[model samples]
Target: MLSLLTDQQALPEPVGPLTMFGPDFPFAYDDWLAHPAGLGRLPEHVLGTEVAVIGGGLSGLVTAHELMKLGLRPVVYEADQLGGRMRSASFEGHPGTVAEMGAMRFPPSATALGHYLDLLGLSTAPFPNPLSPLTPGTVVDLNGESHWARTSAELPTAYREVADAWEKALHEHAELSMMNAAIRRRDVAGIKAIWNRLVPKLDDVSFYGFLSSSPSFASFRHREIFGQVGFGTGGWDTDFPNSMLEILRVVYTGADDDHQRILGGCQQLPLGLWDYSPGRMAHWPEGTSLASLHDGGHRPAVTAIDRVGTGFLVHDKEGVAREYPAAVFAAQNWMLLSKIRCSESLLPGPVWTAVERTHYMGSSKLFVLTDRPFWRDIDPATGRELMSMTLTDRMPRGVYLFDDGPDEPGVMCLSYTWNDDSLKFAALPADERLEVVLGSLAAIYPGVDIRSHVIAPPVTITWENEPYFMGAFKANLPGHYRYQRRLYTHFKQDGHASGHRGFFLAGDDISWTAGFAEGAVTTALNAVWGVLTHLGGTTAAGNPGPGDVFDQIAPVELPED
Candidate 1:
């Protein structure tokens, strides 16, 4: 019998200082690059460049790649390593398999991303189909008793409510196509109007509250399952906080098979980007800082750009400094606010405060590598396949699943989720935490001897503690939906005006498809187009028109009950 563990009290407290990034974390990539040579000489020459991109993550990288294609030399600056939030780790003991500690799964409607994969010559396979109702997979309650929900259709009423919301959210806010009307005409006012009407609804109310309050939302018996599955407000806090209508717009616009994992790992995409860059665009000399205005009117902007005059000056954790005429402010909104010394104060008081106070939920993933296929037991009565399980808690909603091992059959991956409190629990000593997790797992699956089967120390990535990324992803606060209009609108306005003339903003936070990889790529493409148009490039015209693309794809068809 397979059971799921669903008690927080049983879990051990997390150990160590909450590893969050602050002003002290290195902001300039050159700092780390120069550490080997002990040479920290900053650049002083004016190297004319059309644009400077910051943050080597998908957004920055894709933007740079597009710029390069447009015949412009766009320099990229990464504060730490590439692949911003999409970081993966391979344990020493577990050689072939890898675990994603950061971003996971991509949505289907990401056409540009598909193009990116094609560019790198990477082929994708369908995600492993989840277990069907015939399998007796367990769903644990707060008391540690487990009950099985046969299929997603058989989920408890509460679970259904949340799932309904998820399905609704997906169809509503799936892609950028919904915003085509405003984007194509650059109708800032129209977008703002739509945003102003939506922000107030997201304040304070958790996802649970939204469903419960909605007249159209049907109630369910296992409402708590929503939290367990990480769907509702606290469970799955997305970057976009607009009204349900706007959120639904995103869901309906994007592709259906959007949720997919890369065959090798997320790292392959970035490494491929680095490898593909031409000699002129790829590697830069170590310890050589891009020129700044202070040296000779040749300021090279760092990741979070603040202001620019004769040259460019960007301020990040590295302190307020100037760079050459080109710079990229790739840091998050809060980070950008901290570094950039804006003369006009592009961000308003309320918006700035919201950005500062917004609390992002915490998340962590554990990849377990085994020498052999562990779960091969057959259920005599149902004969259904079981690949994963979901555990519920009174407080934190934790989800875990077994993924195909990278190189071999026996290899597997496990992932977990926790809110702020659960994250605090994760701070306990490793042994203690391990014991608690294993204890929980043992309760769910009495057959496996977890203590004896351990092959490697688990690798954990705490998004809450990451300096550059303050939290896993953005979530809608109580009233954030109302402010979202102003937030996105002003973000674009302030981003462009920050410095470097045509510098624009792109990322998960800014896009309507927030909290997904598709959002990141969509925004990056938009920012690139903006940059190209500013640079007098005609590539935008050469690219397939959004309308043409939209017309080619058939509309989604929902199944009948």
Candidate 2:
């Protein structure tokens, strides 16, 4: 493995170099170059088939798997490697251990997740919990003094007034949920009522704006906590605006799972699928040349489709084309937009703009290997563990530690979310960013002297720079409520000339819990239901309604609206 830092001399040497080969390498640039003659490297002819699914991420794979069970042999056209963002990195020193750089854990509420696991014949294990007595808390550097910041407690005395104002806002928009239900059922009057209420709010006013301008509003200190807990910030002036009720709805209604980290890592899920499918599954190399489609009726159609379709052509970066009766576009929304050449524009201007421009959080993980469980010493005064000292703002937010050490051995993975432009880091010499990350680690854990005890070089996965995945996961900006609606409505198979018939959209983007494993699973289940409907199959078989698997799990009650 290439040493990211120049101070390698200061650190212990590794046994071997790190290799970056994986099933998930980006395939856009190379796959487009390997098309067969007379095919234009794109799907030129329209072929009739049962189904063709494009993009091989979780969404696409799950959809195809569901279709097969429904008696349809769906062809999956994946551009790069399978598993999409769920790529794992190999470290030389850790023989059996793998570091996951994408899609870490799944929530229990996602029935599809459990079903998919069973289908793959994989079992679940509780996420590693060493039970260190450290209570995780956010600390802010205030005038060089580290002060604990608790969102709800840190609010000023006047916060209640702001909360009251937010309550009133909720009452005024009390009919919003009804409007949403109406839109879901395609009720014209209901949709009209919603548009009437929402249009006035869209004029120069953002969600943040409404919150701040409200008589009861205050600072974002406490508001941010709500946001972190999946609640919308009650700030009116913020670009990502929503009623306080909507915020509460997210907090109360979203899926919850105490389990973290799959037993062998997330790769087990896909590996199980491959094992189950065996000869039926194929892992194509990037840039493989595709066969030509001669008859328009028999030929596959290459178009960016959100809905699952009967027949389509998929052209990979290698110029290889595969004709399938149905295709699932399972990659990120923006990435799919670039690959499929739609005959007519399905996504409208504003909706497409939101999909392409919505800022997503960037994620990077730092894996540290130690000879033993060294951070066991707890600080009795603050109830914080020695490992907890490693939390700092200089790097990313939500940094977590895993026990990948020997005997009690485990991996300590720290995650960071980038707030600024990632292009700035990509522009810098690679060594510079490495130096910054190392410096931050040094600040967090001064005792171990990572420079000396390091077993392997740090592995970094920059979600922002990745070609197929432009960013880590979806995060709606202030005043972008319409974007969420658009994600659901604009991609449906609603008889639009540009829209795909039977082609369905699924992934973290379309579901309510955007940027989570549960969202991906939920979207996949939804897509499966659509596929079943098209095949004259019962929805009950494809979608085992809510409370089927999770009813046994205890309910978690959050602050009620």
Candidate 3:
């Protein structure tokens, strides 16, 4: 330990507020969207031209919605319901209390998503993450030992040690404070200079390795404890072994913590964009929205995408086909192989490898509506809620509480697990899964009576089991930095070797940062720029997108073999 009495000092403090987007591209698009000059408008000639958007999720919907504003028609295609991973299911009778089946939390710094939230007139409150400001208290159960605390200060010594070490690691080792300051100022040169230096060092390193190298976590015990109870975003055990870059992007961006959720559900953002009437529009009559163009409906799921002449032909699930001048694929990258019949010519070998190898992290959530905030009833001896927002080193990794009020029904996420933990329940039925979760919770809180108060059956989903979404979101693995570089830069130019111009790709997977909605919105915006540019439109001199200035501010692209 560096206990030098001669040069001694206290731990260094974090420099600035949180405002990062991803590992690279630190310039905030949230600031760009707020600028007086808007995203570039399409040239007059291409105003009414039709572009096909495959997928109706947040990415696809945002693509279509923005195209309308720039004077283009987007024919959206979807196989299932509109909100892909943003599904919100309400208890049969209690419409007021609903369960967020997917994408429950939103980070405050996700201003790209916030732009839509503000425009849609949606309201949000602090999400009740374990040990988060919104939660009155938190309960951490590890190795059959339960610790209850409102803050890390209130937890046991070991927990406090882990928390303090993480804070120091982020500030000194990860350079979180400096990067955050640059991002806040939208300092393109400064952010790139700092982030580019980090890429080579962190790219091939495992997140666990990154932590182990830090002075504060030199031993396995500290690293192990840190993984079991990561400060922000719950247990990071799943991502501990992933690429350090993945962990850096997550922790740096506000995605991992200080989150909020739409009052009703996060799905409303996409659903709201569907019918959103743009204050300004192009080529259409006075009032226009993605909904009005599609007659308030989306085309069937696209089964195949083949290049026809210079354009692309997309076939629906029923084999119904349509042709468009250009196409923006907004679905998960895996869909290109398993679900959609992709043309080999559409993507050359390298890009196809990037798409095929894009790793997705699986996730599962079990939700149940209770008669009331049953956990709120305090125990005289413990002086805490029956259970704190629970996080355990057990089968059910993280548990969240959504308290509507004491009078109204409250929803509790009995279990939210990721990766292999989620895969374990892939074969389990809803009832069986519920039993497994309740058993896990019962083990975590031995004396707590959680079952008798159940008001209705639980809602459970393992995203990996769902055919449409093979996994939760992209969790880039070690040495996959090149793949992300390839995926994100593919849309910037049309003249690739494959003669595959006008076929743009946009989604969370294609963004610099994966998993978060900010990435989804960023990629969608990139595709919009690609679409407009492909249709002979040019960005205004004042407003240039990431694609417009990709060269100077481009993140460190790993050298190809």
Q: What is the alpha-carbon RMSD of candidate 1 to the true structure?
A: 12.6
1 or 2, greater by lDDT: 1
Off by over 4 Å in 2: 1-50, 118-143, 147-249, 254-259, 277-311, 345-359, 377-384, 389-391, 404-409, 421-434, 444-448, 490-500, 535-561
> How do the residues 320-404 of candidate 2 rate in per-residue lDDT, one tens digit apiece?
5655544455667776556566433334565666667655666555555555545555556656555542223354333455554
Top candidate on TM-score is 3
Best-to-worst ranking by TM-score: 3, 1, 2
**TM of each candidate vs. truth:** 0.68, 0.64, 0.95
- Candidate 3 weakest lDDT stretch, 10 residues: 1-10
Model 3 ranges with Cα > 4 A deviation: 1-17
| Model 1, span 1-561: residue lDDT tens | 001111111423323111100001101211211233211111223123446676777777776665554444566666667777777677666655677777656654455566677667876654332322222453544456655554545545555455555545432532223233332333435433443343333334455555555543444534444434442112333322323433343433322222567877777786566556432321233222222111212223353444455345455444545354443344465556554455334345545665565445566555565554445455455463332454545322343444454345343434356555447545665455555666666666565664454577766666766776767766555545434433433323323444324445667665444566655665666565455434433222223322223223212212222
* Candidate 1, residue 427: how far the Cα is off, in Å: 2.0
How many times do residue backbones clash in model 1? 64
- Model 2, TM vs. native: 0.64
Tell me the deviation in Å of residue 555 in model 1. 22
After superposition on all CA atoms, what RMSD does each candidate show versus the true structure? 12.6, 14.2, 3.6
